[model samples]
Target chain A: MLKQYSFEKTAVQTFPDNVSLAMRTENLQVFYGANHAMHDADLGFPKNQITALIGASGSGKSTYLRSLNRMNDNIATVTGKIWYHGVDINEPNVNIYEIRRHIGMVFQRPNPFAKSIRENIVYALKANGIKGKAELEERVETSLKGAALWDEVKDSLDKSALALSGGQQQRLCIARSIAMEPDVLLLDEPCSALDPISTVKVEETLLELQKKYSIIIVTHNMQQAARVSSQCAFFHLGHVMEYTPTATMFSNPQIPVTQDYISGSFG
Target chain B: MEQTNFQLKKQDAQSHEWDARLHRATRATRKDWIGRGISYLCIGVIILVVASMLWFITSKGIATFTQNHVSLWKFLSGTNWAPDQGNIGALPMIVGSFAVTFAAAIVATPFAVGTAIFMTEISPNKGRKVLQPVIELLVGIPSVVYGFIGLAVVVPFMRHLVGGSGFGIISATFVLFVMVLPTITTMTVDSLRAVPRHYKEASLALGATRWQTVSRVILRSATPGILTAVIFGMARAFGEALAVQMVIGNAAIMPKNLISPASTLTSQLTTGIGDTIDGTLPNNALWSLALILLLMSLFFNALVRFIAKRGQLKNGR
Candidate 1:
């Protein structure tokens, strides 16, 4: 067996003073039973910018992203402090549901509820106690528009969301998340399942969304990170190996591992 | 000359091998045909048995109107059920069957659904491992045992609490409720488990509480499946003979109240068929009741199929 690298002692990079953070985590660790899946993942997501967490498979990028909103609570035991709005969300007493409302997520797959397009957008809004018909309709249109899907699906608002094409379904999922007006949106490989055209469309949507919400994304595609993200974190063996501006990270990676990974020598 | 002879001998061996391979292929084809024939024969036999049983019931049931000359409408709609006097109204038994089954469903639904939700969604993995098998064991228990329990426990309990004769609609309903609980719970758990984890995650990610996720997203998505379970449970309660017969007073009268004595079609058939002479009007009337039970179950089966198809359509399958 190979020697296990201890990532717990690795130093996390600090952001510049000019950057404003929307959310940050401190000493986050995840364990599935006895297996420590992630170790000491301290990362910061800047406000109104897209931050991409890129790594090879099993590098714990997705796990760290999921912990931001406590989505990992269902299956894994997460430890350490997720700092948001002067509160440690990882505390046992914290209301996970309330936190998740502000930190919405879009999954790797397009999992639109077996509902209509309109209902898909308004479901979270309604769950948050938005009952006005006019307001619900308005949010549906606005959210769909924001995801760049309204022009295609606005005419068929009542049709089942499942009937849409794969790319459209993914956009609908995006719209569904933004409908909640979450301050931060975490996307786990949102375009990894889509075709090239859909991928580009989603990348464009993420770029536009960065103006409104802080976005943290985990992507296996390095080019996607280069395209959409302002800040990029390269994870290796459950540690942030390098955190830098996306342009510099792509053009002149400071670490040899990040350089090797970006050059596709090994993943 | 020796080399040519050897080549000829090798060619002969290759041809022999080819012949053997062809023979084996033919034999395999023959085996496949035999297997297919057996499958078709088994299916045909099942169809034949069911068709014959249906034909027998239909012919015998119609004989009540033809040979005995009992008015068909009166036999169905009339309130009185006297074979010797030949009044023979089946309305009370039909009503009793429906009432008992409805009451059982009402009693069992919440409990079964709650248990199912606990098993699938709420319970931890270890708890699920234990609870699932126990509920399955409940299903394996025989109907007679359930009847005995109803007689020994529920009947007496009702006597003390509800001031009844301890054997009536109330007792029958309680017994059927327990009887159908396992089936409904198992099916509901399966349906709930069939819901994709992604749907729950999506709802939860939207900040919905666990209960809200289950009720709005999981249950709504699983509606068609849950409805199918309810229909299946109702069918079981409707067709159940021994348990309901033992707990229900088996009186030929209409159910006056929840505590009043009543009789279902199955109860009447089981209790009256043995005493009445075969080939009599009363026997044919009992056959008619069996026909009605068969029809009701068939209706329920059709309803299940209809709902399943609707679900498929909604899913765009």
Candidate 2:
């Protein structure tokens, strides 16, 4: 099975000099006890843009995305400089609780809290010391509308979120995240558990959100990456194999591994 | 034509033989029937035993009210409890039981819930491994031993501190607190552990601190279980006999204060049952007191079941 394919190990590509980045990583590495789960990787997310991380399972795309928000602190030993607003969030003294407020996330499965839909949206707002009833109600509507779920759920805002279908629950998760008005929204296969119709709806919501928030998504569906993202990064063996425009990456991949992976030779 | 008729006859005979064998095999075997019969008999025996116990207790408990012509309302509301002079009022004992149990619950709930939270959430892995078994070991200690310790240490200490005879509601409450702490803590830990990890993760992702997540989400989700734990502890305190009797000073009178001597239902039954003759009014009155204690226990169990059922309904399970 060893073909005469030359695999190049080059530095990950960066955005152009003039493009301002919303968040980026510098030499990010993750370790689970002794096993080096993710190698040192550097990547940039441009402001107000959609970037999709595409990789096979265990290729560390999800790991890389999770590390950006410091979600891996309790589980793994992550060492690297996560640069946002001229501060390294990887420092031990940094308050991860405060940092997470600015960088929201949605997990793969739809994990809406076992609370009412409106309470789910207002939970973080209340925790952040916003108590005005008028302000909470206004923000709840805007967030749900932003996620494109206001029409279906506006009538039942007080109903338990678990009563919603899987797709609605996923959209509600997106709504819950955006309710905090974060600068960066990280989604890890947010549509993997959804049907095609729900997938398309969530993709549209992400596209609409890109006007106000920089979105970084890790998706298994290659067509979803080509459909929605402006920039795409192909990860292989815990490293970014190639970073390019979504159209070019789909149509004419420069790396042999990327071409083989996209063409379904080996995923 | 002759060969085809013979073959058909042979096939029909063979099929009939096979059907006969199948019918015989499908019928219940002697062993199976015997086992089923034994199972039904065992169930019947259990029902009979429970019914007999209930009938006996009910018959004996109602004799004082019906045969002895004692006024049920006065027996419940009257303050005095002298059995010899025809005064069988149980108000003091009922109030004493409730007061001691309530005080014990108030004293124990916070500590037990805190210990449960520490064991399940905040403590390190090794510490939890060590602490959980140690707490479970506390439950294995005998109630009499706990009572003896309370009598020797807690009662004397309270007498010195509060300036009254040490046998009272406070001393009994302190003993019951120690007795129920392990039970409530164990149950609370189990319920807290039952909460899905995703709930905590979602809260943490929203920038909430661990404490906030535990209090708002985890505890809220586990409210039924925590309530069940508290009720179980309260039930145990309510029914406890030896330890409470030892520390409570067993004086059948209306408790004046935390330090004044009092008597619970169990304490009165234990202390008075020995002196009265069988089938007498005094004995029957004690039996009625026992029936009340039984009813209280049943009520607590029903409340626990109701809370659990409501929790299930809310969860839509």
Candidate 3:
């Protein structure tokens, strides 16, 4: 119904050898029972940086993000090589649970476990066999501080996480993932359900987190991509259309679809 | 003033039309009233029947203690229940009823939880296609058929295994366990399905295995609902009469062992009601048993409501 863009002329870039990559995909494609939801999405996330995947509704950015930790295991058929920490983690025999421990995910909705704030952070830690009281308490504090939530929630660690405000819940989710001390954090529109103030707070937390964890965030908000990301990848109709520096993609988009989308003329 | 009067005249005409429309008995409105009136009449009839039954049972049950001069504590605490020979103690039947119901619930709960987990979390599509109708058919089965099967198969099996009359507490418990299994399983499946999808997703994304996720988060969130299901199954088991009567030997004595013949409130009431005179103590004692059954059902319902309210409070909503 709208003007269609050619997928053949995508402006994806290849970083030089000196730029260290935390994770990379080689021709990653996704299929939901023959629907081919994502196609040939080969992208790289740099170490200790935030890369935002921006796109419209039905774009494959979220699909691609979910494939990194194999979260789409039963939901869709993803085919390609997902290289993480010098291993092809996409293989079926690879322990996805272990993969996820090193590379964590945060969902669009703020889905904190129906637990207390301390328990929400310590649940996965305990499951991973961290059973000491002092270590658990320390990880809870440090992860909460890492997500910038410690100052507000320090006094009430026993309170139910659901009792927190929406912003605080989202931040707690970030802390829960960071508590695992993941090398890469994949967020699928983590702030889309949040209010403006919450969104700004999440953005600030993300910027602060980039120094430790490699973050790949899929968002529908263009300004969020510009503000929080150093690298930007624009997706359209299951294709990766443009990948560039965040400033360059905002100022001079390499393709018509990316330009029209960010300028709000996308029909 | 003239302009306002002209506007007022127009408004008066509009109001007259509005009044006519308001009073008009449109066909749709008449149809609505007829439907509502029929439903209300049905509910009224049910309410009247239930209220009258309650009144009749209460009066007749109270007659045993008041008109026949039996003390409340003796009726509740005494064990000998020879109603004809004036030894009417209802404690044996009370204990029998509770024993069978609790035994059945405890045996069936683990099986129900396992099946419900399979239906909801493990293989949902296959469970829906295969197990759904199977459970529905189980619910639709007549209690008499279940009783018959218990009499033929389970009774003989118990006789061979334990070397007794085959009709005892264990046989009735086996029958009731089968009967209440489907009820608990279906309700448990519903509650498990009601758990939010995001809880499972969040747990899995945090690198927890499926077992850990289901046990820690999904099952934790659904605990109240699953408890309600178990309680509902227990209520059904407690109230089921004819099936339990057929398998449980109607001997009104204190049960000493699992294999011994015992009498529940329902079994004793059914066995003795037809043979007793209207004003006699035996008939009145049967009525008293019915009252206890009614009160126990009400207690179970209250317990379910309490659990649900507590669950909501814990969820912080």
Candidate 4:
């Protein structure tokens, strides 16, 4: 057994990069067909900082990320209140779309719309009601640059997005979310499928992106969280074992499970 | 080493001799030949049947069409449909087919797409499992039963609604739309289901609601397959006779309104040929009209196939 970090012990501590809460999950639980997959979890994400949710398979890290935008509302029976900027978005009157528009998500796999590369970025903008071509073009360029994919794809924006490499597609997806100008970005294992080189590119993109948007990333890679994130939340068996600064979580993890997971002894 | 090489060549020669000996013993038997012969003969029979039907219709229809020096303009423009007076203007029947098919598609397409989206995206796991099989059962119901229901129930209701001239294109179309709904729904569901789940997730992750994801991403991605389903439903409606024949008024005059009594090209051919002489020009005209229906359906199918192929290629790249 490992010592658990309680909310009382950690809640009062302020992050080095002092920023307001972009999102905070309270007692989130999820079930699928009578099978409980995620138990009660509470965590707060600081604005303009990368918060990494690290866990083994089935630790409910992905579930926690999904609940940030109520993305699990479609296929699962989810119970929780996720607070965003002082408002509880789980209330019936709170519009999920408006909530999500402020909190964009990038999935594990790169799923570009079966459309042109240019249209991929423009789709989010248009769906949010941007109709002017000139403004859209400018946003597209700005987002591509932010994702670190502008130079490779700027000449072929009109081509189908499926033609791009895997790394490029993932970056394009990031660019798409950025184009929406969301205040927070949730990434679900965004680099699990990429090669090491591609993973490095993605981590670099995340490092640069944290300057503008608060990010909560779900990852199985311990070193990745160590490298890019400022805060780390280590989850084990649906319970959050520890929540601390990345350096402290890596070097002085309070839980044996988190230690075993980080040392590659057992998942 | 040279002596070993010679031994390897000698062994190869011995194996070659054994292979030839086995081949001679395994010669094909009479039964094998008979089976092959029957397979070829069956294929020939299928081809013959299809060709004979085509020839029978074309040989007779071409003569009638040419002998009448058929001004397609007069045939299309003339509204008179009464054959008792020796005037066979088919404009009424053509117009009737269009009205019925259009009305049916208009009502059925939206329902099909909506049900498909629900099945593929919205329903709970249990609800999806239960609803899918129940929806599939709709397609198994016979068209004749549909006709009987329309005749016994729908016509009278329309009679109350329109007050007179109840069994017309509108009533027939209502029944046809319901009948086609199952096919369209199933096929549309298949197409929507085929869209990768990631697309839906991607859209929703962007903060698009379920409806927005369905309308903008899932539906757009599944457009080609859905178009194929609609085209198929339209073809089925165009060729539908059992239900339409019972509900349609069978009046051989032009319909001035949708609720007015009318006849379609198929209804005329079926009832008209039964009362006419076997080899008369009117009988030949039936073949000509049937040929026209065939051409129209073929054109529609080809158009759909072209679009579907283009979509597949685009997706493939």
lDDT (tens digit, per residue) of candidate 1 on B1-317: 99999999999999999999877757779899999999999999999999999999999988899999988789889889888778799999999999999999988999988888888888858547898888889899999999999999998999999886888998999999999999999899989999999999999999999998999999998889998999999999999999999989999987889897899999999999887778998888898899899899999999999999999898773
Candidate 3 local Cα displacement, residue A245, angstroms: 1.1
Taken in order, the candidates have interface RMSDs of 1.2, 1.5, 1.0, 1.2
Put down candidate 3 lDDT per residue, A1-267, tens digits, no spaces. Answer: 678788888899878989999999998999999899999988988999999999988988899999999999999999999998789998999999999999999999999987899999999999899999999999999999999999999999999999999999999999999999999999999999999999999999999999999999999888899999999999999999999999999999898888998998887
Candidate lDDT (C-alpha), each = 0.90, 0.90, 0.93, 0.83
> What is the per-residue lDDT of model 4 for residues A16-47, given as tens digits with 9 covering 90 to 100?
44567888778778787688877767778888
* Candidate 1 regions with alpha-carbon error over 4 angstroms: A1-12, B1-25
Task: Point out the worst 10-residue segment of candidate 2 chain B by lDDT.
Answer: B22-31
| lDDT pick, better of 2 and 3 | 3
Chain A TM-scores, all candidates? 0.95, 0.96, 0.99, 0.92
| Residues A161-214, model 2: lDDT tens digits | 999988899999989999999999999999999999999999999999999999
When summed lDDT is taken over every stretch of 10 residues in candidate 4 chain A, the lowest stretch is A5-14
Candidate 3 C-alpha lDDT tens digits along B27-51: 9999999999999999999999999
Error of 2 at A14 (Å): 1.5
Candidate that scores best on lDDT: 3
Candidate 3: list runs displaced more than 4 Å. Answer: B1-36
**Model 2 docking grade:** medium
Could you give the candidate ranking by TM-score, starting with the highest?
A: 3, 2, 1, 4
RMSD of each: 2.9, 2.3, 1.7, 4.4
Error of model 3, residue B81, in angstroms: 1.0
TM-score quality measure for candidate 3: 0.97
lDDT of 1 at B114: 89
